[model samples]
Target: MIPLARRAAIGAVLVGSIAAGVLPAGAAQARPLTPATDREVTFTVDGTVTYGTLHLPVHRRGQRMPAVLLLPGSGSTDRNGDQPPALTPHTLAKLADALARDGVASLRFDKYGSGRTGLGAYADKPETIDYPAFVRQADAAYRLLARQPEVDRRAVRLIGHSEGALTALMVAVAAEPRTAGVGLLQPLAERFLDVLARQLHEQLAAAVAAGQMSPEEQRAIGRAVDRAVADLRAHRPIDTSAMPAALAALFQGLGGPSRRYVESIDAVDPASVARRLPPRTPALLTCGTIDPQVPCDTTTPLATALARAHTAGPGRVVLPGVGHDLTDPADPDVLAPAALDALHRFMRCGAPAAR
Candidate 1:
């Protein structure tokens, strides 16, 4: 389950300080978040109608404002960073509202399997969906934002979290002249399978450390993962009958679109893409030091590559004690201040008041 959830930020069991029975020090009940004006918007990609919410800041007419396209992480996560059975902290919605307050407009959409899209063109057949489709959706959204009367065509930026980070990069690198920059939060920086295998190894090793899994069991799990990867690489069906329940879920996902998507992206190295980005294309690479899905060590090197390309803004930010969800590592309910500050700074890059 952990492996599958980490694959696309889907189905991963939710954990936090409350779940761990260790609340944050002095943590208090959170106040109700203020609602902002969110307009229902739709766009067509490959003839498939996609749905989303456009967040707008208060502004007078004729004011051409900067805008951002928000891409949520993997799985069936809606525009709010939630996949039912797992309630997120409304991470993407919060970010949208935050951007609005900072005088920037934002658009956040529900991908195929989530929200109003309802699988779109992949309703009956899941195998047709892959990484390129995500990139196309993001590209269409960016174009829509740029054409809005209230938006500055040259100031359209993209913000992607988790797997969406790769989609954002794809859009940025393939964007029209209007693309301003990109912000990657908790990006997957390695080959898709390598990252998944490493995560599985870590989980198994941790279980062994806690006396829950024996050395033999751990080795067996490693061998199983290797075989599954080999099969996926060959475009063959994965055999999960012999796997543990948690791991079986991961491979069972390989029977559908997840399999095709994973296979398509497993070979696309994110750092290699970053290194080739146009020098003037600014980027913000952020990672939480404690993000279980994406290790800070992995993001650090991607940041270094972007910096070498002269596309990084300031430097990589590893927020202390934050989670893959961009909230308190211990208490998922609490938003991390450092992450918010860094995002704010990155969104406002190159302005007179840029941090």
Candidate 2:
């Protein structure tokens, strides 16, 4: 029989959906060509099962290269961060291409329950969806790359986008031999509930001020947010059925992932998580200035979180105009300019000095 510790380690790899509201593309930039050879890889984490693509660079004569294992964000998205542009599709393939230009290889896997992957639609509990276990899979991928004659074993990194970014941080800290670094996208600096409340407050208040939701509807939404936050903080199972009838419907839609997560994650401060993270590895905390979801304010907290943790060898970078994905200097994928510059410098600076 597998020891419980071994079983937990084996089970730790397992890992969302969303009612998203993103603006349609008007001024969006067209995607550029990203060089990669797509290959499939199965990812089994926790009790859930999934699959993703290994985006390998086509150019390799004899030299080995470093690689990144990308953890994607939520919802019905695919390995390339492919989704309707309105939702801030990460354009992950685009990013992969960007990295390819830098001689870095990447692997992007489908989230649970999508593509050729299994439907991990149901989980026993949020804690059961272990983030650290995925690190093992990440370690496996690193080993896979290292075994490749074209991969530089010492240079592998983990680049997670958006919510995926947090998972990357978790994985980096848990790396068996430790990871070189991470590329974090939009992640929570505040507690999950606080960020949710603030985003809703901003949007709803604007709408109420502009008379989008009727005062009655607005009041109902307000009550719903308050009740949800309160129940989450108290660890009380949300009475979705008893929620204001209109909002009750919304509550149910948050079933499975969001409901389970909000319940377990309300008290988790991402900054606090960072502060307590094991100091075994270094990291690169990057965020965008105009990120629609995380925003500049939240990114500040993230940077503060890493700093407060005294992320000594690690560093933080905030992009301007870029949104969550750091794709644009606009709203959602806001990546910091200095952060991008910093990453290039760091990656190069860490190259062998004796060689």
Candidate 3:
């Protein structure tokens, strides 16, 4: 196995059903694009069969095609890069289709807590889910891609978004020789808790600036965040009862399987991990100015670390006027042109040196 390593859909939800609270319930569901061939596939991990979609180029011209294993972000998100209870645009699906057009095949699977895999993959034990287990899953997916008849084993790649990007980095650190490259889009780059604290503070500050929140409230939230992060670091249960609803939700999301899970990932310094990657491994590090969750300030260190390690490609692929969702700032309805271009280039060639 090349080592690396969703929510069950109710019947036929509209593809647009992914938009979190934005689209009207009556909005039309998106139909699958006809260009690339998509096949439903599965692989076993820890004895549980995992589900995924394999996208292939419409017409393969005699040559073995490159392959990529796509990992979705956090939450109850499915293989399509969607989390129910909110309709998100099909981010991973779009990326996979785009790659198919470029003659690349990709496999995107539902994660443990979401989609078909469900939390059962955790054996009904949420505490079993942590950083290393996630890394192992990605490694398993990489091996699956390698065994594909249409794939070039040596050219298999990884593409991860949000938390998935962090997982991708860990996988890269111990990647097999055949593992080709990695694409990290909007990844958590700093120590996990530190990044979480930064995001919480920024959001609170923004709310205060917008007059939606009081200065006093922001301070209270900040203090709570700091305390919780500190407690998590100490392996203590976080007290969220006094926190604002927003702060409470944030903490609960990050502190999965209890405080220990938070501690496990928080101890991981993403930059430090990047430093351990084989120097010759090519990487595409992307940061969007408007990505509230992974602000440039937080992720820049990881990008710098990659540069320091001489990760192949143009050091940092800066996405100006882009959002955490990969949408264009000017037109939130469309994917950022720069993002699409960068992805196409990266998928085509593991490394495209800086201009």
* Error of model 2, residue 88, in angstroms: 7.6
Off by over 4 Å in 2: 1-36, 46-49, 58-62, 84-90, 120-149, 213-220, 237-247, 255-258, 265-267, 276-282, 312-314, 329-343, 352-355
Q: Model 3: per-residue lDDT, tens digit, 87-166?
A: 67678887887787677889999877778887556766788776676677778887877777777777888889888888
Colliding residue pairs in candidate 1: 1-246, 17-330
Residue range 281-340, candidate 1, lDDT tens digits: 768888887788998887766887898778847557888888888886556665688888
> Scored by Cα lDDT, where does model 2 land?
0.60
Error of 1 at 38 (Å): 1.6
Q: Rank the candidates by TM-score, best first.
A: 1, 3, 2
**Superposed Cα deviation of residue 26, candidate 1 (Å):** 46
lDDT for each residue of candidate 2 in 1-355, tens digit (9 for 90 to 100): 1123766655543310121234345312232333457767664555456676666775535545677777766555567775555554556776676667666777776664345553463434433443334445445555554455555656667777766666666666656435666666666556666877787767777888997777777667777787777776675766664345655666555544555555555545566667665553455666666667877666676776677665554466666656655554433353244545655754653453210
Candidate 3 global CA lDDT score: 0.76
The TM-score measured for candidate 3 stands at 0.82
| Candidate 1 global TM-score | 0.85
